[model samples]
Target: MQLLSVNLAAPHAADYTDSAGRVTGIDKRPVPHPVLVTAPGPKGTGGSGLAGDTIGDPRHHGGDDQAVYAFAREDLDAWAAELGRELPNGVFGENLTTSGFDVNSALVGERWRVGDAEDGPLLEVSCGRIPCRTFAGWLGERGWIRRFTQRAAPGAYLRVVEPGEVRAGDRVTVVSRPEHEVTVAFWFRAVTTEPELLGRMLAAGDALPEESRERALRRGA
Candidate 1:
């Protein structure tokens, strides 16, 4: 798939509102490159205490690569038109925006390579949907979380396989797929609705990360 837009967030002050009212954290800022590394605490170091969590669970503020959105090529023009700009800046408050890929079909353990054969980059990423309020706030729509999950385009949470520079217009290639037929949407369903599938995923082995396995086991038990 072709890259639509690459976004990033440095460290800016913004209002983070929750049950405790508004607490300020780093506001979302755009970055020059596609990849962004955020830690559980402030700055880009330290592990988020959450176990087996990919995007949410408080370990990551924005998480790895934080924002990488993908869309179908056919919808590109329409999406651009709707956003009032060539590309949307804060649609999901993402760092990267993409098109031409069926991102929804990606499974939890899928890997993707960026760039081209001659000069390209490789990133193996795990799939996970943006969680509720965090995602909703980004979209500026209260129902965005549900809408996104229902749409099943669940984007992805990425980790650097071989760290490198990636920009908009770079090519994205799917290098491999998980052993099972399960997809990102499937995993979302399994986690929220069918807790049993977590165990199934763990039993399937290599299909999921070690952290994911532990969480699944706990949920299943």
Candidate 2:
């Protein structure tokens, strides 16, 4: 697989109808050059690993477990076809728009070497992105959140394992895959609609984020 584009956004005031909806940096735009990818501190830091990216709401965005967000070009294409609109690379607020990658099918704890061997970053799949009202407001689609949830293809969030520069056209190699059946799509479905599947998510072990893991365990209990 390859990185189609590297997207970043700075904090800006938005008309999003969620929780005051003031400083949301979800309107990411593609960058021409390589950008540094690193851990942006802790969970409530409200910043991203991408150099120019910003996280508006610390309470819900930006954390070590969510240092990077990636979406597949194939998925975007599907959405575009269904919505009958042009969905650009960064339109969904993803940091990396990837080609030839099945991000939704990626297993939790999967490790991907992004870029070349000479200079690249290592990223570990952590969890599926949880859709929120900001996303619906941004899209302005009627029943957008529900539609997205029903589709169950929320992109994956990743933790930076080896921080480095990443740019468009960089190669993405799956370095390792955890022996688990909990794919991002499955996890998204479990957390969003299938309460019975929450117990199954625990099988992914430490591959899941702490909060998600705890929630799954609680549900399973």
Candidate 2 global TM-score: 0.96
Q: Estimate each model's TM-score.
A: 0.67, 0.96
Q: What lDDT would candidate 1 get against the real structure?
A: 0.51
Write down the worst ten-residue block by lDDT for model 1.
48-57
Q: Which residue pairs in candidate 2 have backbone atoms (N, alpha carbon, C) closer than 3 angstroms, thus clashing?
A: none
For 146-168, candidate 1 gives per-residue lDDT tens digits of: 65555555556555555455666
For candidate 1, the clash count comes to 6
lDDT of 2 by residue, 1-221 (tens): 99999999845787673434687888898999999999887887546989888788877888888999999999999999999999999889999999998999999999999987667999999889888888888888999989999999999999998899999999999999988799999999988899789888998998899988999988867
Task: List clashing residue pairs in candidate 1.
Answer: 7-95, 8-30, 8-31, 9-29, 12-27, 48-59
